[model samples]
Target: MSRLAIAAAAGLAALALGTAGASAQTVVSKIKDRGYVVCSGSQGVPGLSRPDEQGVWRGFDTDICRAFAVAILGDREKIRFVPLNAAQRLPAVQTGEIDFLSRTSTITYSRDTAVRFVAITLYDNDGLLVRKASNITDKKQLDGLTVCLQGGGSLTEKAVLETEEEFGIEMKKVYFDATIQARDAYFAGRCDSYVTDGTAAAGQRATVAKNPAEHDIIVIGKGTEPNGVAIAYGDDQLFNVVRWTFNALLWAESKGITQANIDEKLASGDAEISRVLGQEAGFGKAIGLDDKWAYNVIKQVGNYAEIWDRNLGANSPLKVPRGMNALYRDGGVNFPFPWD
Candidate 1:
């Protein structure tokens, strides 16, 4: 065959392979057919992902799952949260056991290779929680103190070590198989402090402590933890849907759009607002859903601020400060990707 003919044949072959690659990622379609999304969670971590008294999951992580459900199915009530331990979190996503993970997992180099991180939903820090009587406000106070932490080379272990190194101090670490064991031991005075991610520490103090007022969350390393939404790799379509749903939440917050004001915003004449609200944009169609996907998220599950306040801030038992989790405009770290 002539040179041009050979080139044309090669192009056709490439197109065929690309088409097959695209067709293989059907997570979105499967979710649509199933009527809901399956999100992975811990057994119960107050202010994060934990079942309430009525057996319904409620927390920041669970609310993130709800946002995904709203964006994809347009139903705030349609979602299933399955409890998975630390060992099971990543594998479940890789094996299709869970549709995604919102268990306040920090984005790490090794984890990024195994699954696609949809977005940084929370900016957390590893911390040391001590009794109010201890008055351990400075890292200098941590030197030589025994800390109760989860063992097995987990992030908690790493956080404790990082604190020791950063503060120019050395700590005695007592590691346990499960966080509860470590926390229970800490409450029992087995150690001087409890080491874990800041949020988990806050949760433990709020829900497990005999007197929540006796404990305090002393943030460890500078906000090094970028907790993310994790989904399986090899499925860009599914990844984009989850990612943009998170973005929609942040974007809504950036524009001061709340659950109570979304309908009014939707009726506004602003073009970008209209597009983001799905009144004039094809965002949903571009991601293989109703144009009202973002609209549904804000309207039903609420914007990021609403979820945070209700789950981790003013409205919840934890009442943790927004800190790094707040929107950038509000003097925090969160910001939305451009909708256009």
Candidate 2:
């Protein structure tokens, strides 16, 4: 063959390969073209994903979604929050109804294999909520008792059932649509126990009953689950975007970086923080985002600790301690993957 013909054939092959690479990297490009990120959250859990009196979605889960928007889209407001129930969360992500689900979903082997968990933002555990007057302190005392549960294939129910068998007890299940309903039934003595996550149990108990202190909704038994956010499986581009976005938040918190300190730190050129925030090194570019992706997230949404403190800390009505949610430095299991 002529040399010119050979060179032309090689150029065509290179062009075909470039097209394939572009198609493989379509997730980020598609999201940017859409102009917004659709995020799934819960309807109304006071400190988790409820709308305030001003009609704005605010909570730990909501903050995570907004952070993703800031990272990928560079605008915290460039997100649409779709409130989904426990059952709807997985299907929505799988069907592409939303880009991601930041609802308080527990990551499990079944869920991780079925749906995709981008990152574990929060570590949660199951606990029992009972009226102080009921005097049910331990799981052993609940044999043959009625328990209020949110019963539409809830993992919380499964966790309770597993615990019941482990403790050699039997409890009746009374189904309720929402935690509020179940809490009311428990407080009114309609059921003997309320089974849910420790944070959720505390949030529900504090909402009703004049003084939460008057009701002894203790966290009985060890936590049976780990909660986190969900993304669609098999989308490597989107998964990395979501995963590293979460890691950036946790890393910032671990390094004692806050929204207030982000600007000064970026200007000061701290090597570690700058690299993570994409100020000194273009880490976001490696992850299919602009260099300022992490900076935008920290500036707009704050870090993981800030979100936890604002929604579930001592100042908030939930008043739950960090416990296992604290950073590794503070004796908790929240360790961040190295940005490098």
Query: lDDT of candidate 1?
Result: 0.86
Clashes of each: 0, 1
What would the per-residue lDDT of candidate 1 be over residues 60-125, giving only the tens digit for each residue? 999999888888888978899889877778999999999989997888989999988988998887
- lDDT for each of the candidates? 0.86, 0.80
lDDT of 2 by residue, 193-244 (tens): 8877777777766775577886655555545456777877767778788888
Error of 1 at 18 (Å): 4.7
Error at 185, model 2, angstroms? 3.6
Off by over 4 Å in 1: 1-21
**Residue 206 displacement (Å), model 2:** 2.3
Q: How many pairs in model 2 have backbone atoms within 3 A of each other, for residues 3 or more apart or on separate chains, i.e. clashes?
A: 1
